[model samples]
Target: MLHYLLTLAIFFAFFAVEAWGLNLQFGLTGILDFTYITFVAIGAYFAGVAAMTPSTNGGMGGSYIFGWQLPFPLSPVIGGIAAAMLGVVVGIIGLRRLRSDYLAIVTVSVGQIVWMVIGNATPLFNGWDGIVGVPQPYNSVMNLSTNNYEWPFLGISVIVAAIIFWLVRSLTESPYGRILRAIREDENVAAALGKNVFRYRMSAFVIGAFIAGISGALQIEYIGAWNPSGWTTLETFIVWAAMLVGGRGNNRGMLLGAFLVPVLFTEATRWITIPAHPLLMEAIRGMAIGLLMVLAVRFRPQGVIPERKRVFPLTTIPGLKEDVANGHTAQG
Candidate 1:
């Protein structure tokens, strides 16, 4: 039971990180990034390749690049950088002029392209079989039992989640966050106000991708392996659903949704005995999630925890008091 609880905690940590990233993109900046999982895959593959011993070094049989066999801690950082670079490329191509439905289609197409490339290109991280045998951080130094090591790793995961939460909360409460909200509400108005809308959107995309990459690295480290099968486009939707159910713009809500949707809902499905084919069970799961999404949209569109309204001070502008006293409304 203790071990199970620890594992669940680790999973929650990873989901929290992913949800935070998605909240930044979809909730805060309104990117609607349907291909978000691609960045996570990038991080996982990059970190896996970095940590794995090269075939040239008589390690494994897979052909891949830069098998430096670097330390585990460095893998996530490098992976994050790689994912950020990809985010830039993606943003340049997708966010140039596309909006709404078109933007979503392009992002999904990009995700498909990435998935095909990784699944088919055997030279790159062993293709569909994916990378394996990723080492844990400080494994050698710790030299502890497997169960003992997991506890410390769980602690690390929790710490990382908290730090990410703090960083994202700070970003969302800053002036930049306000600009993002403005852009989300009305891009034209933000642009007319001399805000570089595209730049801000791209920055948000890249930052979110970086966070996703970090979570991906952490995920691969925990699992000790990664394959193409694990990062399908549907994974992106799962995170999106969590955001919707949790309260899009609320960080705490996102955290709760992460646990509720992915952790609890998924785990609950495991115990049910569906008297149907295995494939039917999968279909049932999808249908259940779809129904939940529909209910969320129809009844509680603002999510379980709605975003709080920001209160601006009446004296935000100088001389507003005198204008109000004279029964005159300020004009924009």
Candidate 2:
């Protein structure tokens, strides 16, 4: 039970990471990135392959392209880079003048295409079986029992989450983040102000993808495998739900929603006393998620912790008010 709880805590941390990525793209930048999970899968796959050998190992026999067995952080970092490269490609094609709705459609289509390719290309990602036996970071050195190892792993998870949280929070609060918000609110206005909307959106998309990749790489390390089925479009929706339920534009809300939707609802459903087919439980979980999303949208669209309004007081800037006044006087 302790192990299970520790696992859940780790999951919460990773889910928070994913939520932050989506929030940056969709909430902050107004990007409807439905292909988000594709990047995550890419990250997981790369990280898994990087950490394994070409031969079968770790309770699952599979062969992959790369098996460098790189050290702790390098594999995940490579995964993140791979995801970001894909993001650049997708952003260039999809972020160039499409409306939000159309962009969403394109992203969905891209995700489907990628999924089909990964599932069918046996050489790539071992088809549906995926690559397994991804080594936990620094496990060889630690050489602890399974349960004992989890304690330190849990600490690592929290630290990673903190770094990502700090990075995103800082970026969102910076001037660049304000520009992203402006784009989300009114892209046309931002464009009119000489902002290169496409560049900004692409940057956000790539950065968000990189973060998603990191989360996926970490998850693969924990789970010891990566498969196409694990990264369905539904996973993307779940992240979106987390952001919405928490608060789209609020970082703290991401953590809250991550706990409620993914951690709470997901874990709680497993023990539900339903006298139905076991497979039905999975369906029920989906229904619960759908219902939660609906309720959140209909009753509390702004989320439990809505984004705080940002206000700029002109008086706060030194001499700015006087400068403006003098300019007006001179003009008059």
Find the candidate with the highest lDDT and give its number.
2
Tell me the tens digit of each residue's lDDT in model 1 across 1-332: 79777888888898889999989988998998998888988988888788777755334756777777788668888888888888998888888873755668878998899899988987887788777777777787888777888898998888888988998999999999999888899999999999999999999999999989989989988888888899876688778888899999889998999999878886546666666665677667677777888899899988999987888766677878777777676664
Which window of 10 residues has the lowest lDDT sum in candidate 2? 54-63
Candidate 2 lDDT over residue span 70-119, tens digit each = 88688889889999998998887788864787778878998899899888
Clashes of each: 0, 0
Clashing pairs in 2: none
At residue 52, candidate 1 shows an lDDT of 70
lDDT of 1: 0.84
RMSD in angstroms, all models? 3.3, 3.7
The alpha-carbon deviation from the true structure for residue 48 of candidate 1, after best TM-score superposition, in angstroms, is: 1.5
Q: lDDT for every model? A: 0.84, 0.86
